[model samples]
Target chain A: MATLEDLSKAVINGNVAKAKKLTQELVDAGVAPLDIINQGLIAGMNVVGVRFKNGEMFVPEVMVAAKAMSQGIEMVKPLIAETDMPSEGKVLLGTVKGDLHDIGKNLVGIMLESRGFTVIDIGIDKSPEDFVNAIKEHQPDIMGMSALLTTTMLHMKDTIELMKEEGLGHVKAIVGGAPISQDFADEVGADGYAPDAASAVDLCKSLLSK
Target chain B: METFNTTRSNFTRASFEVNQTIFWQMLSDDQCEEIFMTVQELLERTGVEILNEEAREIFEKAGCWVDGTRVRIPSPLTEWAARTAPSRVTLCDRNGKRALRVETTYSYFGPGQGNSFVLDPHTGERRKPVKDDVAATAVVCDALKNIDFVLSNGYPTDVKEAAADLHVFEALVANTTKPIIQYIPSVKHAQAILDMAVAVAGSLRELQKNPFFVYLIDADGTLVHSDETLAKVIFAAKNGIPFIYHTKLVLGETAPVTPAGTLVVALADVLVGVLLSQLVRQGTPVIAGGIFTVRDEENNMLPWGAPEVSLVGTGMSNLLRYLRIPSFGFAGASDSKISDAQMGLEEAFSMLHMGLSGTNLIQGCGLLESGLTGSLVMLVIGDEIIGMIRKIIKGIEVNEERLARGVIDAVQPGGTYLGEEHTLKYFRKEFWWPTLMNRNRIKDWTEAGSKSLGQRATEKTQSILQTHQPEKLSDDVLAKLREIIEKAEAAL
Candidate 1:
């Protein structure tokens, strides 16, 4: 009796336990793993995203919904093939060296995650070598560098140079921070720049499409 | 002189047992102390980047640590500057009458400056604002009972670019007698505008004694002071002109994203100007305030309507009140493109918040589209909103006479107190009558054409533009102002 509609409603309401239990029930009921993910979990997250965009839902509620959907996704992950698991893209995020600020970068990571992107945040005060090593390890589709200080923002350019030396030119590089403008992004040869967290999601989507 | 004396003590009471009016505060005493102490620590440790050499030398002479453009002031110097700055600054009208006592819990609402486009009064189309639009805004502000002062609402595009400030000052002084707050770009414009104010006051010393205008100088954010901003501060201080030292810290840009962190940067930005002014001339009348807001990530705009504006604006007002300095704030502004529901909601909430917080000078009356456009219609509607806010902030009286125990006893259980003398005596004083807002029944409202608030405001604006004539300057003063503008035009 645990239908996909009930699972979707649980995800929308951010009931993580209910979502996980329903996903398991649907799997036991012999429903396809992809069907439960597409119709139950992602369908609810799509509604959350729309509501957030329209200002009807706030950040915390969207975050909770994202958590609920991801919990449901974990229930179906082992049953489905890795290639069939839905994901927008893998994004690697870090705050540049000499800048300990991370609030903006963290917010960007949350926003990207809520939009179905796999965000790997390496935390703050990361140097160019750390970024290069993270890119090689995560092999993400896009790398984002954040810096709150003017002095540390220069490290974004250095990271881009090191990425080129490591022959990771195929991975798109994006930069953003309080002091980062589009002109500065262009000067540093970043693929794109976003002003704040919400735009960072859209920037990632556009870059991955290209 | 009589008006000046009475208006000075009008709102400020010598002493009161209980708070006489609605006293709203966002930050507690402990929080205020913490923020102020943190501001001092930030100033002493990080210091600010000063681009002006003379400013650095002034700080160095005052026993501050000056290493090139980085001048760090001791906390004692900052406390001394706060103590030295006058707690109250009085601004006079062009007719030499006190118009605003910029201090304490007294709040005055007015329009903002430098809107490039204006909502055309007749066609309702957005277009570039000209000098006549500036004059029209001044005239309308002069007629509005709640608008306490006037700011150049439009940056005149028709004027010469180099001398636009002088031209705007000329138009404002020519049209309105209310106290003017002018924005100056550089030291030259500051002196030129001061010369014009001197012309109106008849002499330099007279202008200094009762400045009809206050210079508004903005500081570059992120702990930096540009040379032009410093030069203007020096000019305003040396000439004994009262100036508002203002800055805007867009949350997460040019400042820390957190409200407390933004406050630290904001206080640092403003105190740097205050110290520089006081160092140039002790007891310089400097009002410190700024815009603390977040950039809309989606639209990439600094929204004037965001609730953070009220939160941070009230918080900053509380900080300035703690420091005992007159504060300024932004209110009655919106990111909406027109005079619609969003605009009304945004402006009403901000106006109410600023009024409740008792910000001394609340600007942004008619700003629209994130402060890119000005609308006289919006200004008219905002005046009505401010009138309502003023009544709300007046609070209630609980004395015996106001309690009306005797009147209630005499009236007895719904026996038509409308006919009583007590009712006749207290009705007008107890009520706030709306001019534009309708309180009529549906039938009556429909019979009267059932106009929306926007339509009513537009009509009121057109009527004011048609008939409201501001107090004029003397022929001699007018000629002198014209001559100064011409000279600046030629020189620049």
Candidate 2:
């Protein structure tokens, strides 16, 4: 039997071809899909994340390894969906209005999704009303706001104020973006401020738990 | 003659003490002079336009020979510099003095939370400055180098107090060197700081002798041929103060989403600043700076290594070099938190690109949270990174002397060359020994406390603060500075 360790090594090696083929082969060999995912794919990715978080690995390495894991997941996703599996959480992410940048937000979404959180990436330049509507409809556990420019990061506060005005205070607001600091996040009345995508994911996880 | 020598020795009891380093060891005083001369020749040979006629006259008077676009300062200028350049400045109060020894190649203070794009400490806000904020900003400038010749940051809330606030702030920070970057918000403050600078310098002639100050202000954000910012730039340049043309290109709003378009906008803004600098004071330096930003798909303004950012930076650097203007560029900037993976990646790439492109000074260091926060911890990390980048830029020098002693041939009979004088002399010069990086075995590392880079950096900061007692300035100079500050403050 092909062990999870074998699949984990494949992912670490950035062998997308091998990881995908092994995932399918293991599933075909009557391996449980959750075990294949949790014990194999996620287990493999966790190492990558930890290594990346520790500076043991660099961006290009992590990026390629992430790409490999995603490729493996593509093969197993539908099969896993057919089974009764619980999700980590749902996160609705967007950049506030007047700010069109989103690389940081995208990284956050990828990391969250990798952690099994279903993320609704609403895209950038979204108004506060758009966020409220998304929260109303999706009822996501967390709404992440991102802004790059110092001037535009101010719009995150406006969005939060608008959210408060609209009586949507129950929804948790997580804020990020370049130029957005813990101090600014505090002033803006955000539930959390994350410096980068890795921390953002960690913050979201902790917030969801709370 | 013997009596005269003794008195001269007494007079020169304490000229100055500088931060000694490998860079200092590499160049003798004569070599430093030669390099400066070479730089001047390079500046003149490059076709950077000299726009100001008055500056041209000054350069001519100073024996600065100009051939087409080339400019060269006569040896007399260097001699004059040795005499007039004060070693230290004393910024002070009635109680005492705060003297700061000047450095030839080190960062002075840069205004704004440019060190880190963070919220203002006083108001807990992330926008423009008010009066008190401007006054208190002197603390930031004071914490920097001692010879603050200009009022750097926190422009006043109202135009009425602008000049006065700037003067007070400049006085508080200005110890010995005249403040170069003083933006008198009003005609009164402008006149005041200028007057104070001239007084401190001893005369208008002295003030004009070396215009090594900067003044920060803004221009109208229009693409038109004429603008107030340009006018301010012109005025400062004409007066011998270099202007920093600072602009931020916010992707998706102020600039197009594409990095190219964003870079173009940044380049255009800088060109205007440079043009204004040249037109106002030919041959005076102008920092054509651009802080470019981008928003990703989810609206997160990520610290991206957009090739366009580097491309434009390199292009601008080349252009400025062609123009023979000293260029200051951005490097070692990271949106990541301290000592993390993101920090490693962000800092490494940013430093490499900026250094490779030949930026004269990389301003945003020791900042975190997207340049909104400052951490002493991060600042030390930045220093290390700067050292690393310097090594990368100082490409290996291969020569017959360096190859040395015919060592390989000598060692053909199984003799070791390790005991040779050549190896002893050259080895130390050829290698950079780091202060904090650990290369010990695991056992030794554990035995030696297993301290991380952060811990080591913290220890170093504490050591510098505790042990490095910078030389103090005279009480008279300190009193003069305080009096000027008080007058400026009362005026405000």
Candidate 3:
């Protein structure tokens, strides 16, 4: 009999085909859907999260593991309702105008996504209007802007102002850049600033709690 | 062929050759003499311009022909100067206690000087460092046990233009008791700085007898000496003050493209320098070094982190050892913009070479972007890296006590040693401990903050700045130094 532990080991190994097959096999063997996701996929992800946090597992490994979990979720979601699939929160991320630097921004996006947030990425060199439009469309819990240039970081403030003007100011604004500081974030009306990608995940968790 | 010898001492480890733990050599006696003779040939054939007229007159008095400002010395004069120079120098703390005794193959490190931008540890921004940054740098240097001495750690741009050098030195004196390597711009400024040192030492001749500071001068590549630089060199030599004279040779630009060719030019530059210092005042303490750089068409950057540069630096250090003189070289620096893998690898390899090659007075710690940027976090990492190298250089002990023959006998086959007395006695001393590198398990690391090495370095810098107060100078001495600076300010 296939067990949820087998499904978890498959997911931990980042074997997407094996994970989906084992998860289906567990379901056919009369295991509950919640047992497969909560005990198998989520349990595997929890270990990966701890390892990533500890610097034991790098981004590529966790990313592959996350892919397996997502595929397993695709098989398990139809059988469950919205109440079982727990979404942590939503995050909107973009690199502001005149800055083509997006490697760090994309790392933050992956960090947020892997932590259970539904991240909406607006891509690089995005203007204030692009962020404002994405915010209106996604209505995300947190809006994060990244800039590598000192000149391009001003667009973060402009986007915050547009959010205020549109009466969507309840969304928390977080800023990050190579040149960004917490004092600069406060001066520009951002609620948080993270110096690196991993801290961006902590910033999201802490901000969402408030 | 390679040879290995093992010896034992019961109480302490066996002393290696010359009673040192490790030894590494590059240049031999024949090569040393060849380089010295080459320098003599270069000076006589292709002369250096003794830019100052007084220096030119001194060279002429010593039987050197002068064509305008350029002067050439004879092989006999070069041999005399090299022979007459003192082989050792001892530097002292501000309180007049001997702190550093410098001679062959003894390496120490401190921060380099003259950076326009300092990375704010708190905000990670690049800004012009002020007098307060100098204070912070000195206090941190005081707390770092690995850094043997201090320097005018950065260029403070916010002070009065004429008094900036003194202001930086004052901050250094106030915050740390470590001997300083200072830069005095002119003879007038050197006089003021000398007066300040006299006040600290309580007399001029006493300060000369046990100098608390060493001044430095710059040379423009090979055989290009500026007048002010030469003047400072002469002043130091005359007053029996320790002086470091160095030149930056950018390969393919200021020097030959190949490492060997660049080394030839560098030897010509530094040997000529040492020869001149000895001529000014025999038995004067002079430290010679070359900050060698490499530039190819594919990689035209100032390759401070390149293997080619390290090769030349190691060769120069070996040559200095053969000459029985203290040497200056570089380690623990990088051209990367952050404290990333590139910075770590470059610093680790360069530090290994600097250790094995026996380069005394290693500088360029905490420097980034090839000396254009400074970071205190990098300094913290440098302190750790040097500690590791020093541990490696301590080598292994093979004595019967260290071998633990009795303990091994007591523990039977397939038995454990974790519960034995031998483990408890030697584990801490045998292990190489790290302060910043993380060694935590995954869960524990996640529970704590998941911090990077840069973040850890920044936190360490902040705590040291806030809590570490160095030994201070008396109020009267501070006031006297200020008065001397005021006098120099008037002159300027």
Per-candidate DockQ versus the true complex?
0.00, 0.01, 0.01
lDDT score, candidate 3, position B275 = 71
TM-score of chain B of each: 0.96, 0.62, 0.93
Clashing pairs in 3: none
Give candidate 1 misplaced runs (Cα > 4 Å): A1-210, B1-16
For B355-410, candidate 2 gives per-residue lDDT tens digits of 66555444554445566554444445555666666666666774445644365554
Q: Whole-model lDDT, candidate 2?
A: 0.56
lDDT score, residue A112, model 2? Answer: 78
Model 3 TM-score, 2 decimals: 0.67
The ten-residue window of minimal lDDT in model 2 chain B covers B1-10
lDDT of 1: 0.87
Candidate 2 - CAPRI tier? incorrect
Best by lDDT: 1
Q: Estimate each model's TM-score.
A: 0.68, 0.47, 0.67
Clashes of 1: 0
Per-residue lDDT tens digits for candidate 3, residues A42-127, read 78877777777776665555655776787787888899997766667989999998888876787777667656778899888888
